[model samples]
Target: MIFEMTTQVRVSNFDEGRKWYETLLNKKPDFIPHEGFVEFELIPGCWLQIAEGKPTEGNGPLRLGVSNIESERERLIKELKIDKFEINSRPEVPVKWGTFKDPWGNHLGFFEYLDKDEEKKSIKNNLERTFN
Candidate 1:
């Protein structure tokens, strides 16, 4: 059975890619496997890999969950100089989302659940299952 997972995004320049990912993630990478590769542990077992290479088209829109979509979007815009991407949702949708790309064209995005209580429950459950 699958227990852990990783998703990769590529960039043509190593130093620029590393710095861009650091700004986006708001932390230094958890691991640097070699000169041109790095890994961030997004959750307990989920990893995001950034590598030096030609970026592939249609590689992602690797969406991450956030606490507040609007605030996060604003923060990204001001801090990362990201374009003001539209936040989207539907009447029945439980979460709102927005997507943007890095300088190298690796698609990335963020989402926020409308129900904070449910989001907390999901986090607690996932942590328990992953750790216990």
Candidate 2:
């Protein structure tokens, strides 16, 4: 059974990619296995790798969960200088989400649950898994 996972995105320039990712993540990479490659442990077992190479076209909108989508979107727009994107939701959907891209065109986004209790439960479950 699969217990852990990693997703990779490529960039044309290594240094610029590294700095952009660091700003987006708001932390230094958890691991830099070699030159031109770095990884961030987004959750306990989920990894996001950024590498130096040609970026894949139309690859992904690797969405991440957040506590507040609006604030997070604002932060990204202001800090990363990404084009403003709209957050969307439906009555049948439990979360609201928005998507944006990095300088190298790697798709990324944030989402937030409408139910605060569910959000708390998810956070608690993740914390338990992390500490256990």
Candidate 3:
């Protein structure tokens, strides 16, 4: 039985949407084909794809629940060279979540998480990346 599959995000312009999703997602799209399209994983179960010259409708919200929201944000800011001005301050929303956007205008935000070891490591690494 297959446990993995990919979901493609459709859009009109590959470059335009690719930049948008990448900025919000904070990782490079896993694949690109010149004028064909660019792709990123929403997770192991889903993905976002952008193609050239095609019509794009709604921009989707890509939210993540993180162990340490501030650290994750800081990592993106420092490594990506995103200035402090580029980020939305913490607790952008109630219920324990901080919100922000990717370079292309997709909504990117992180929720507070407390049960994952990888998340803890990610937060620590991200914080270290940001500061030193």
Candidate 4:
């Protein structure tokens, strides 16, 4: 099964939002269907899009959990020519995640997950000891 999703952002201006998104995604809009709508298809199945409209009050607090965040961030800053993308947090928190916002005011983050293989090994070892 595939795990990909698209999130749309609302903004008053389309072109302004497009520029901001380009800076954040480090690429030109690849999924533009019209003048008012622009999309940055980050990967094969994932999408981040924006257009002319206002998201309802308390609409969402959407976040995209990106991997290898440091590398991806370096590429984005260099290739996108953004002035600066502030680092929202350090690695002190429980989530161990850092966040940044796009030009259109959409929040994004780099999330690290535990290694599954290590977890499986530990679980198996504990089960063996208990069962034996």
Q: Which one wins on TM-score?
A: 1
**For each candidate, how many residue pairs have backbone atoms clashing (under 3 Å)?**
0, 0, 5, 0
Q: What is the C-alpha RMSD of each candidate to the true structure, in Å?
A: 0.9, 1.0, 8.4, 8.9
- Worst lDDT 10-window in candidate 3: 86-95
Name every residue pair that clashes in candidate 3.
Answer: 9-49, 12-54, 14-51, 20-104, 24-102
lDDT of each: 0.91, 0.91, 0.59, 0.62
| Reference-based TM-score, model 2 | 0.95
Candidate 3 structure quality by residue, lDDT tens digits, 53-113: 4343345454676656778778777755554533344444333565565444444467664
Give the TM-score of each candidate.
0.96, 0.95, 0.49, 0.55
lDDT of 1 at 29: 98
- Per-residue lDDT over 49-85 for candidate 2, one digit per residue giving the tens place of the 0 to 100 score: 9999999999889999999888888888888888899
Q: Against the true structure, candidate 4 has what lDDT?
A: 0.62
> How well does candidate 1 score on lDDT at residue 47?
98
lDDT by residue (1-132, candidate 1, tens digit) is: 889999999999999889988988899999997999999999999999999999999877999999988988888898889899999999899999999999888899999988999999989999998988
Worst 10 residues of 1 by lDDT: 71-80
Taking the tens digit of each residue's C-alpha lDDT, what string does model 4 give over 5-45? 78888877777777766766667988778878888877556
**Runs in model 4 with CA error above 4 Å?**
1-4, 67-95, 100-105, 113-132
**Rank list by TM-score:** 1, 2, 4, 3
